[model samples]
Target: MNTTKRPIVTGIDGSGEALDAVRWAGRAARLRDVPLEIVHALDFPALLAGGVVPPPEEMKDTLRAHGQRYLRAAQEIAEAQGTTAVTTRLDPDRAAQALIEASRTAALVVVGSGGRGRLTGLLAGSVASAVGAHAACDVVVVRGDSWDDPEVADRPVVAGIDGSEPSARILAAAVAEARARKTRLVVVHASADEPRPETEPHLDPQAATEAGEQLLGELTGEHEAGGITVERVVVRGHPRRELIERSATAQLVVLGDRGRGGFPGLLLGSTGQALLHNAACPVYLVRTVS
Candidate 1:
């Protein structure tokens, strides 16, 4: 029933990481010139014992108070970052479900890698993983040391390319982000093998490099008119390893949710998950909605 217009929505749970996510989302909203919605979802199942019966009035009030505190803190953080267009919501649902619903009307959904939860040992908590895999729009998981370092903003935005349609979609999103940040875009393509013999075996290594250059140009030609600096890179190595290393010095790493090599029914590809777990910057997953 929440028919709010598209905005940048971030999930916060009052933890340091969640607040970090809030700060990142706030800056992103400012860059995009859109409103920021800070959301805190009350754990409905944790509140009740067995049935769907509502808790006592006192308990309900306590939960409401806690949610409000988190919302206020997040709102203050966003405001301090100069994101004046900010709103707060306290949804009585699970964190992942609340964020999933918000994604339906959100230009982007941001969340911390981990937050207040029982599974603290995981690199990414259940809520983060669920939303990352299922959000309707692009999802950003705020993690790694570079995410909190102010100097990282000066770095370029890195885009992983595999010549797939999904990769093209992610490249478009990455270009927009780089343009908004007034930073350069690094387009990287990594492959472990030579050009497939069945496809383009006639092309030598130098020619293959030229092909990569041409492909990058074609993929980003439209955006070049916008004055965005782009660097084209072609590396012969494992795509996942190469991308993870490239992400170490980048401001943000963008990748398609699934690439050509992804399993038939997988929502998130293996390479995407590897980067999500190991990237040294915030990872943006751009999924094509079917």
Candidate 2:
């Protein structure tokens, strides 16, 4: 598949949060001049409690109607977000599975922080986590009140790096995002307890902090292009905790899928579950290694 031809896909479950994802994805697609795809999933597996293949025709029609309604509303929201080319789909597969499959040809996959309706797991947090873990492309779990906060519009875009995963791609994405938002970029390398590398037997706390700061500067210096202000932050705290705290004042938070520090592995494992659930803004995740 051609990377430039891929669409930005978002899955909705008739929830307000899912609509929020649509709004975000729509703006993103417009910015990149790509198509925005809005999807609604009818999770029929849960409806098979009666031990039947599809339950019944009436039930299937009702589910389809609901899905169509949600997709219609999502389409309106995306269009209002200034997305010129918009498309929609009603998938019969499970929410996680459908989104994961769609991700195969998508540039990005998006989902809400949660859902409230029965059979509307498309917006559920678990579904978001699943997609984040297994999606073929980068994932963004739409969370927090950053969208509704008036002051958050000017917040910087944050990128968390542990120096474990490949920082180049993560830094590049953060720079692009900050440039698009016309905001500053904050590159953070946090250490919970000023921990040192296991291979180094004599490294002290001060040395560790120095090392982290040096790494942060060296990794981000090359990415300080596009006239966007870039700031380096090396704080003493858990990476996840620091990142989540910083997220409160950020428009977007970017992280690698796997690493050490507080970011041992987000989406890949439960290491970053707290950060995902409590992020104050949209969390954009990218796999460090393809």
TM-scores for the candidates: 0.90, 0.89
Instruction: Find the candidate with the highest lDDT and give its number.
Output: 1
lDDT of 1 by residue, 1-290 (tens): 12354799998887888998999999988888788999999877676767667678788788889999999989999988878789999898999999999998899999998888737457777787888889999999988865667687789999988887676788899999999989999999875532354765566667767777787878878877787898888876777898899888999999888776665678787777888778888999997655
Question: Which digits, one per residue and each the tens of the lDDT, describe model 2 over residues 188-278?
Answer: 9885533566785765568868988988888887767668999998887788788888888888999876666434344463335656778
Which regions in candidate 2 have their CA more than 4 angstroms from the true location? 1-4, 49-52, 117-124, 193-202, 261-271
Cα-based lDDT for every prediction: 0.84, 0.81
lDDT computed for candidate 2: 0.81
Candidate 1 — number of clashing residue pairs? Answer: 0
| Candidate 1 ranges with C-alpha deviation above 4 Å | 1-5, 51-54, 193-210
Clashes of 2: 1
> What range of 10 consecutive residues in model 2 has the weakest lDDT sum?
262-271
RMSD of 1: 3.2
